[model samples]
Target: AQRVTQPEKLLSVFKGAPVELKCNYSYSGSPELFWYVQYSRQRLQLLLRHISRESIKGFTADLNKGETSFHLKKPFAQEEDSAMYYCALSASSGSARQLTFGSGTQLTVLP
Candidate 1:
């Protein structure tokens, strides 16, 4: 079974400070890591994916296979960046892909 863990349930950082959301996963085969964010009243949306290797909204996450971790980082956190972030893992399951999500970390950017 694949599992995702976000060590911190709540994380806070001051505006313009660096922030990182820790994410760890356990899977047998090759897996894809993703970051999903949900604003106060908005639906959950994809923030970034390991496969993309791109930064979105000043956030970036690198998949570390050696450590089985994919931590989201941002150099300067903005107030608007405050949201609930979830780490997700995707792997092939039979004929389709299965997505497993973490409990999620709520990030609060203090003014």
Candidate 2:
């Protein structure tokens, strides 16, 4: 079974401070990891992925196979960046592929 873990359930930082949300995974095969964010009263949206090698909303994450981690980082967090973030793992079971989400981490940017 593939699993994703987010150590921090709640994180708080100043508006201009750096923010990081830790994510780690355990899987037997190559896994695709993604960061999903949901703002207050908003639906969850895809933030970034390891395969894309792209950054979104000033947030970026790198997949480290050696450590089995994909941590999301933002140099300067903004008030708008405050949201609930979830680390998800994509795994394949025969012909069906599914996404397993972590418990989630709520990030609050203090003004």
Candidate 3:
């Protein structure tokens, strides 16, 4: 079974501090990994992907294939960056499956 586990349900802290949103996954095949973020009431946006090795919204995610994890990290979080983050993966197919989202970690950035 493919599963994504985000241990933290909520993370609250002040602005301009480092933040790490942990994520671990289990899958038999090589699946595509991604970090999805939802701010306020907006749609979920892709933060980063394992294949891309890119950072978005001041965040970066590293895929540790051996560890079966893709943890999201940010050197310094901003007030505007406060949002719900989810770790997701999809197995591509003739008809690609929907991105499975984790429970979500509510990241709150104080003023």
RMSD (Å) of each candidate, 1 decimal: 1.8, 2.0, 1.7
lDDT of 1 at 63: 92
Candidates 2 and 3, the one with greater lDDT: 2
Q: In model 1, which runs have C-alpha deviations exceeding 4 angstroms?
A: 93-96
lDDT of 2 at 41: 100
- The clash tally of candidate 3 reads 0
Give the winner by TM-score: 1 or 3: 1
Q: By TM-score, rank the candidates, best first.
A: 1, 2, 3
Per residue, candidate 1 scores C-alpha lDDT tens digits across 15-109 of 99999999999999989888999999999999999888999999999999999999999999999999999999998633347689999999999
Q: What pairs collide in candidate 1?
A: none
lDDT of each: 0.95, 0.94, 0.87
Residue 95 lDDT in candidate 1: 39
Tell me, by lDDT, which candidate is best: 1
TM-score of 3: 0.91
Error of 3 at 19 (Å): 0.3
Q: List the residue pairs that clash in candidate 3.
A: none
RMSD of 1: 1.8
